[model samples]
Target: MKTLYIVRHAKSSWKYSGINDIDRPLKKRGIKDAHLMSKVLNKMVDKPDVFISSSANRALHTAVIFCENFGFPHFNLQIKRQLYSFSDGYLVKTVNALDDGFNSAIIFSHDHGINTFVNEFGNRPIAHVTTCGIIGLKFKEKHWKNIRRGETFLVEFPKNHK
Candidate 1:
Protein backbone atom coordinates (compact mmCIF):
# COMPACT_ATOMS: atom_id res chain seq x y z
CA MET A 1 0.00 0.00 0.00
CA LYS A 2 1.09 3.55 -0.65
CA THR A 3 0.15 6.60 1.35
CA LEU A 4 0.28 10.18 0.15
CA TYR A 5 -0.01 13.15 2.44
CA ILE A 6 -0.81 16.38 0.63
CA VAL A 7 -0.34 19.55 2.64
CA ARG A 8 -0.95 23.15 1.67
CA HIS A 9 1.62 25.70 2.70
CA ALA A 10 0.87 27.70 5.78
CA LYS A 11 -0.48 31.25 5.69
CA SER A 12 2.08 33.68 4.34
CA SER A 13 3.11 37.07 5.66
CA TRP A 14 2.36 40.02 3.43
CA LYS A 15 4.45 42.34 5.58
CA TYR A 16 7.33 42.46 3.14
CA SER A 17 7.29 45.15 0.48
CA GLY A 18 7.26 44.00 -3.11
CA ILE A 19 8.13 40.47 -2.14
CA ASN A 20 7.75 37.76 -4.72
CA ASP A 21 5.09 35.16 -3.96
CA ILE A 22 7.73 32.43 -3.92
CA ASP A 23 9.74 34.37 -1.34
CA ARG A 24 6.91 35.07 1.06
CA PRO A 25 7.47 33.73 4.58
CA LEU A 26 4.92 32.21 6.93
CA LYS A 27 2.79 34.36 9.24
CA LYS A 28 2.76 33.94 13.03
CA ARG A 29 -0.55 32.11 12.89
CA GLY A 30 0.76 29.98 10.08
CA ILE A 31 3.76 28.94 12.14
CA LYS A 32 1.57 27.99 15.05
CA ASP A 33 -0.80 26.09 12.82
CA ALA A 34 2.05 24.26 11.13
CA HIS A 35 3.30 23.12 14.52
CA LEU A 36 -0.14 21.99 15.53
CA MET A 37 -0.56 20.03 12.33
CA SER A 38 2.85 18.51 12.74
CA LYS A 39 1.94 17.27 16.22
CA VAL A 40 -1.20 15.77 14.82
CA LEU A 41 0.70 14.06 12.02
CA ASN A 42 3.22 12.68 14.49
CA LYS A 43 0.42 10.74 16.06
CA MET A 44 -0.53 9.07 12.81
CA VAL A 45 -0.21 5.33 12.42
CA ASP A 46 1.61 5.66 9.13
CA LYS A 47 4.48 8.12 8.99
CA PRO A 48 5.79 9.34 5.66
CA ASP A 49 8.93 7.72 4.33
CA VAL A 50 9.83 10.72 2.21
CA PHE A 51 9.15 14.45 2.24
CA ILE A 52 8.66 16.31 -1.03
CA SER A 53 8.06 20.06 -1.17
CA SER A 54 8.08 23.03 -3.48
CA SER A 55 11.15 25.26 -3.47
CA ALA A 56 8.95 28.17 -2.54
CA ASN A 57 9.80 29.60 0.88
CA ARG A 58 6.42 29.11 2.52
CA ALA A 59 6.06 25.53 1.37
CA LEU A 60 9.60 24.65 2.27
CA HIS A 61 9.20 26.22 5.70
CA THR A 62 6.06 24.23 6.37
CA ALA A 63 7.82 21.01 5.34
CA VAL A 64 10.69 21.88 7.67
CA ILE A 65 8.39 22.20 10.66
CA PHE A 66 6.87 18.80 9.89
CA CYS A 67 10.31 17.26 9.66
CA GLU A 68 11.34 18.75 12.99
CA ASN A 69 8.25 17.57 14.85
CA PHE A 70 8.29 14.13 13.22
CA GLY A 71 12.00 13.58 13.94
CA PHE A 72 12.87 13.28 10.26
CA PRO A 73 16.18 14.76 9.17
CA HIS A 74 16.02 17.86 6.99
CA PHE A 75 18.46 16.31 4.54
CA ASN A 76 15.80 13.78 3.55
CA LEU A 77 13.62 16.48 1.99
CA GLN A 78 13.48 16.69 -1.80
CA ILE A 79 12.74 20.16 -3.19
CA LYS A 80 11.13 19.90 -6.59
CA ARG A 81 11.11 23.09 -8.61
CA GLN A 82 8.19 21.86 -10.73
CA LEU A 83 6.06 21.89 -7.60
CA TYR A 84 6.04 25.67 -7.61
CA SER A 85 2.85 26.84 -9.35
CA PHE A 86 2.52 23.64 -11.26
CA SER A 87 -0.71 22.30 -12.68
CA ASP A 88 -2.58 19.25 -11.45
CA GLY A 89 -1.18 17.14 -14.27
CA TYR A 90 2.32 18.29 -13.49
CA LEU A 91 1.83 17.54 -9.81
CA VAL A 92 0.56 14.06 -10.58
CA LYS A 93 3.46 13.42 -12.91
CA THR A 94 5.87 14.54 -10.22
CA VAL A 95 4.29 12.20 -7.71
CA ASN A 96 4.26 9.28 -10.12
CA ALA A 97 7.95 9.80 -10.72
CA LEU A 98 8.87 9.44 -7.09
CA ASP A 99 11.07 6.54 -5.96
CA ASP A 100 9.27 3.28 -5.44
CA GLY A 101 11.09 2.73 -2.21
CA PHE A 102 8.94 5.37 -0.63
CA ASN A 103 5.80 3.61 0.52
CA SER A 104 4.59 6.80 2.15
CA ALA A 105 5.28 10.39 1.06
CA ILE A 106 4.39 13.91 2.07
CA ILE A 107 3.96 16.73 -0.43
CA PHE A 108 3.81 20.39 0.64
CA SER A 109 2.59 22.88 -1.92
CA HIS A 110 0.06 25.62 -2.72
CA ASP A 111 -3.68 25.69 -3.31
CA HIS A 112 -5.77 25.29 -6.47
CA GLY A 113 -3.17 22.96 -7.89
CA ILE A 114 -2.99 21.01 -4.65
CA ASN A 115 -6.75 20.89 -4.44
CA THR A 116 -7.00 19.77 -8.04
CA PHE A 117 -4.32 17.16 -7.60
CA VAL A 118 -5.99 15.60 -4.59
CA ASN A 119 -9.44 15.72 -6.10
CA GLU A 120 -8.22 14.15 -9.30
CA PHE A 121 -6.49 11.21 -7.65
CA GLY A 122 -8.18 10.99 -4.28
CA ASN A 123 -11.66 9.76 -3.47
CA ARG A 124 -12.96 13.06 -2.17
CA PRO A 125 -14.24 16.13 -3.97
CA ILE A 126 -12.07 18.81 -2.46
CA ALA A 127 -12.89 22.37 -3.51
CA HIS A 128 -10.24 24.14 -1.46
CA VAL A 129 -7.20 23.36 0.62
CA THR A 130 -6.70 26.05 3.23
CA THR A 131 -3.38 27.09 4.69
CA CYS A 132 -1.80 24.47 6.94
CA GLY A 133 -4.32 21.90 5.83
CA ILE A 134 -3.49 18.26 5.13
CA ILE A 135 -5.19 15.71 2.87
CA GLY A 136 -4.20 12.10 3.35
CA LEU A 137 -4.75 9.40 0.72
CA LYS A 138 -4.09 5.69 0.79
CA PHE A 139 -3.58 3.81 -2.44
CA LYS A 140 -3.81 0.06 -2.86
CA GLU A 141 -0.90 0.03 -5.27
CA LYS A 142 2.63 -0.48 -4.15
CA HIS A 143 4.25 1.95 -6.58
CA TRP A 144 3.41 5.45 -7.65
CA LYS A 145 3.10 4.41 -11.27
CA ASN A 146 0.23 2.14 -10.31
CA ILE A 147 -1.70 4.94 -8.64
CA ARG A 148 -4.86 5.86 -10.48
CA ARG A 149 -7.88 8.06 -10.07
CA GLY A 150 -10.37 7.20 -7.31
CA GLU A 151 -7.92 4.94 -5.52
CA THR A 152 -7.84 6.84 -2.25
CA PHE A 153 -9.10 5.05 0.83
CA LEU A 154 -8.72 7.85 3.33
CA VAL A 155 -8.94 11.65 3.44
CA GLU A 156 -8.16 14.10 6.23
CA PHE A 157 -7.44 17.78 6.87
CA PRO A 158 -6.47 19.84 9.87
CA LYS A 159 -9.55 21.98 9.60
CA ASN A 160 -11.72 18.88 9.96
CA HIS A 161 -10.46 18.59 13.52
CA LYS A 162 -11.86 21.89 14.79
Candidate 2:
Protein backbone atom coordinates (compact mmCIF):
# COMPACT_ATOMS: atom_id res chain seq x y z
CA MET A 1 0.00 0.00 0.00
CA LYS A 2 1.19 3.44 -0.85
CA THR A 3 -0.06 6.55 0.88
CA LEU A 4 0.22 10.05 -0.47
CA TYR A 5 -0.44 13.21 1.44
CA ILE A 6 -1.26 16.34 -0.51
CA VAL A 7 -1.19 19.67 1.28
CA ARG A 8 -2.08 23.11 -0.01
CA HIS A 9 0.24 25.75 1.31
CA ALA A 10 -0.90 28.01 4.14
CA LYS A 11 -2.38 31.43 3.40
CA SER A 12 0.23 33.85 2.13
CA SER A 13 0.74 37.54 2.63
CA TRP A 14 0.14 40.01 -0.19
CA LYS A 15 1.46 42.87 1.91
CA TYR A 16 4.77 42.92 0.21
CA SER A 17 5.17 45.12 -2.87
CA GLY A 18 6.72 43.85 -6.08
CA ILE A 19 7.34 40.39 -4.63
CA ASN A 20 7.04 37.46 -6.98
CA ASP A 21 4.32 34.88 -6.36
CA ILE A 22 6.91 32.27 -5.44
CA ASP A 23 8.52 34.54 -2.91
CA ARG A 24 5.46 35.50 -0.91
CA PRO A 25 5.70 34.52 2.76
CA LEU A 26 3.01 33.13 4.94
CA LYS A 27 0.74 35.40 6.91
CA LYS A 28 0.17 35.34 10.69
CA ARG A 29 -2.97 33.31 10.28
CA GLY A 30 -1.09 30.97 8.01
CA ILE A 31 1.44 30.25 10.72
CA LYS A 32 -1.28 29.52 13.26
CA ASP A 33 -3.14 27.30 10.83
CA ALA A 34 0.02 25.40 9.91
CA HIS A 35 0.69 24.71 13.57
CA LEU A 36 -2.86 23.67 14.22
CA MET A 37 -3.13 21.41 11.20
CA SER A 38 0.28 19.83 11.70
CA LYS A 39 -0.62 18.86 15.28
CA VAL A 40 -3.90 17.42 14.10
CA LEU A 41 -2.15 15.50 11.30
CA ASN A 42 0.48 14.18 13.69
CA LYS A 43 -2.24 12.64 15.83
CA MET A 44 -4.11 11.20 12.84
CA VAL A 45 -1.36 9.46 10.90
CA ASP A 46 2.16 8.14 11.17
CA LYS A 47 4.96 10.26 9.77
CA PRO A 48 5.35 9.74 6.05
CA ASP A 49 8.52 8.17 4.66
CA VAL A 50 9.34 11.32 2.76
CA PHE A 51 8.33 14.96 2.72
CA ILE A 52 8.54 17.00 -0.47
CA SER A 53 7.63 20.59 -1.18
CA SER A 54 7.56 23.15 -3.96
CA SER A 55 10.47 25.53 -3.93
CA ALA A 56 8.03 28.40 -3.42
CA ASN A 57 8.44 30.04 -0.04
CA ARG A 58 4.88 29.54 1.16
CA ALA A 59 4.79 25.87 0.33
CA LEU A 60 8.29 25.22 1.67
CA HIS A 61 7.45 27.04 4.91
CA THR A 62 4.32 24.96 5.43
CA ALA A 63 6.27 21.77 4.75
CA VAL A 64 8.85 22.88 7.30
CA ILE A 65 6.13 23.27 9.92
CA PHE A 66 4.93 19.75 9.26
CA CYS A 67 8.47 18.41 9.37
CA GLU A 68 9.11 20.11 12.71
CA ASN A 69 5.87 18.76 14.13
CA PHE A 70 6.84 15.25 13.10
CA GLY A 71 10.48 15.71 14.08
CA PHE A 72 11.57 14.96 10.51
CA PRO A 73 14.89 16.62 9.86
CA HIS A 74 14.73 19.83 7.83
CA PHE A 75 17.65 18.80 5.66
CA ASN A 76 15.89 15.59 4.75
CA LEU A 77 12.99 17.48 3.22
CA GLN A 78 13.29 17.60 -0.55
CA ILE A 79 12.57 20.79 -2.44
CA LYS A 80 11.89 20.52 -6.13
CA ARG A 81 11.82 23.54 -8.37
CA GLN A 82 9.59 21.72 -10.80
CA LEU A 83 7.04 21.42 -8.04
CA TYR A 84 6.76 25.19 -8.10
CA SER A 85 4.51 24.71 -11.11
CA PHE A 86 0.84 25.74 -10.91
CA SER A 87 -0.40 23.03 -13.24
CA ASP A 88 -1.58 19.52 -12.50
CA GLY A 89 0.59 18.13 -15.30
CA TYR A 90 3.65 18.97 -13.27
CA LEU A 91 2.04 17.55 -10.14
CA VAL A 92 1.23 14.31 -11.90
CA LYS A 93 4.71 14.06 -13.31
CA THR A 94 6.20 14.60 -9.87
CA VAL A 95 4.08 11.89 -8.27
CA ASN A 96 4.76 9.44 -11.07
CA ALA A 97 8.49 10.00 -10.63
CA LEU A 98 8.51 9.31 -6.88
CA ASP A 99 11.07 6.69 -5.85
CA ASP A 100 9.54 3.28 -5.23
CA GLY A 101 11.71 2.86 -2.17
CA PHE A 102 9.36 5.11 -0.18
CA ASN A 103 5.87 3.80 0.31
CA SER A 104 4.46 7.05 1.61
CA ALA A 105 5.09 10.65 0.68
CA ILE A 106 3.79 14.11 1.42
CA ILE A 107 3.75 16.96 -1.08
CA PHE A 108 3.20 20.60 -0.22
CA SER A 109 2.16 22.67 -3.20
CA HIS A 110 -0.06 25.41 -4.59
CA ASP A 111 -3.86 25.38 -5.10
CA HIS A 112 -5.17 24.74 -8.58
CA GLY A 113 -2.64 21.99 -9.17
CA ILE A 114 -3.17 20.38 -5.79
CA ASN A 115 -6.93 20.50 -6.13
CA THR A 116 -6.89 19.15 -9.64
CA PHE A 117 -4.49 16.34 -8.80
CA VAL A 118 -6.48 15.20 -5.76
CA ASN A 119 -9.78 15.22 -7.63
CA GLU A 120 -8.27 13.27 -10.50
CA PHE A 121 -6.23 10.75 -8.52
CA GLY A 122 -8.33 10.37 -5.34
CA ASN A 123 -11.69 8.68 -4.98
CA ARG A 124 -13.21 11.42 -2.88
CA PRO A 125 -14.67 14.51 -4.49
CA ILE A 126 -13.52 17.59 -2.69
CA ALA A 127 -14.96 20.86 -3.93
CA HIS A 128 -11.93 22.72 -2.83
CA VAL A 129 -8.87 22.29 -0.62
CA THR A 130 -8.46 25.24 1.71
CA THR A 131 -5.17 26.68 2.77
CA CYS A 132 -3.33 24.46 5.22
CA GLY A 133 -5.69 21.66 4.30
CA ILE A 134 -4.53 18.06 3.94
CA ILE A 135 -5.88 15.25 1.77
CA GLY A 136 -4.51 11.75 2.23
CA LEU A 137 -4.94 9.22 -0.56
CA LYS A 138 -4.11 5.53 -0.39
CA PHE A 139 -3.17 3.48 -3.40
CA LYS A 140 -3.35 -0.29 -3.73
CA GLU A 141 -0.63 -0.50 -6.35
CA LYS A 142 2.86 -1.24 -5.12
CA HIS A 143 4.56 1.12 -7.51
CA TRP A 144 3.93 4.83 -7.48
CA LYS A 145 3.88 4.94 -11.26
CA ASN A 146 0.99 2.47 -11.39
CA ILE A 147 -1.08 4.08 -8.65
CA ARG A 148 -4.67 4.69 -9.63
CA ARG A 149 -7.71 5.88 -7.75
CA GLY A 150 -7.63 3.93 -4.48
CA GLU A 151 -9.05 5.76 -1.49
CA THR A 152 -9.43 9.12 0.05
CA PHE A 153 -8.60 8.23 3.62
CA LEU A 154 -8.29 11.60 5.30
CA VAL A 155 -9.38 15.17 4.69
CA GLU A 156 -8.66 17.96 7.18
CA PHE A 157 -8.98 21.70 6.96
CA PRO A 158 -8.34 24.51 9.44
CA LYS A 159 -11.90 25.78 9.33
CA ASN A 160 -13.29 22.44 10.41
CA HIS A 161 -10.96 22.37 13.40
CA LYS A 162 -11.58 26.01 14.26
Best by TM-score: 2
Per-candidate Cα lDDT values, in order, are 0.85, 0.94
Candidate 1 lDDT over 1-162, as tens digits, reads 888888899889999999898999999988988998888878874668999899999999999999999988999899998899857766787789989998889999888888888888887787778898888888888789879864555455666665
lDDT of prediction 2? 0.94
TM-scores for the candidates: 0.92, 0.98
Could you tell me which 10 consecutive residues in candidate 2 have the lowest summed lDDT?
85-94
lDDT of 2 by residue, 1-162 (tens): 899999999999999999899999999999999999999999999999999999999999999999999999999999999999888888888888999999999999988998999999998899999999999999999999998887999999999998
Instruction: List ranges where model 2 is wrong by over 4 Å.
Output: none
In model 2, state the lDDT of residue 56: 97
lDDT, candidate 2, at 123: 89
What TM-score should be assigned to candidate 1? 0.92
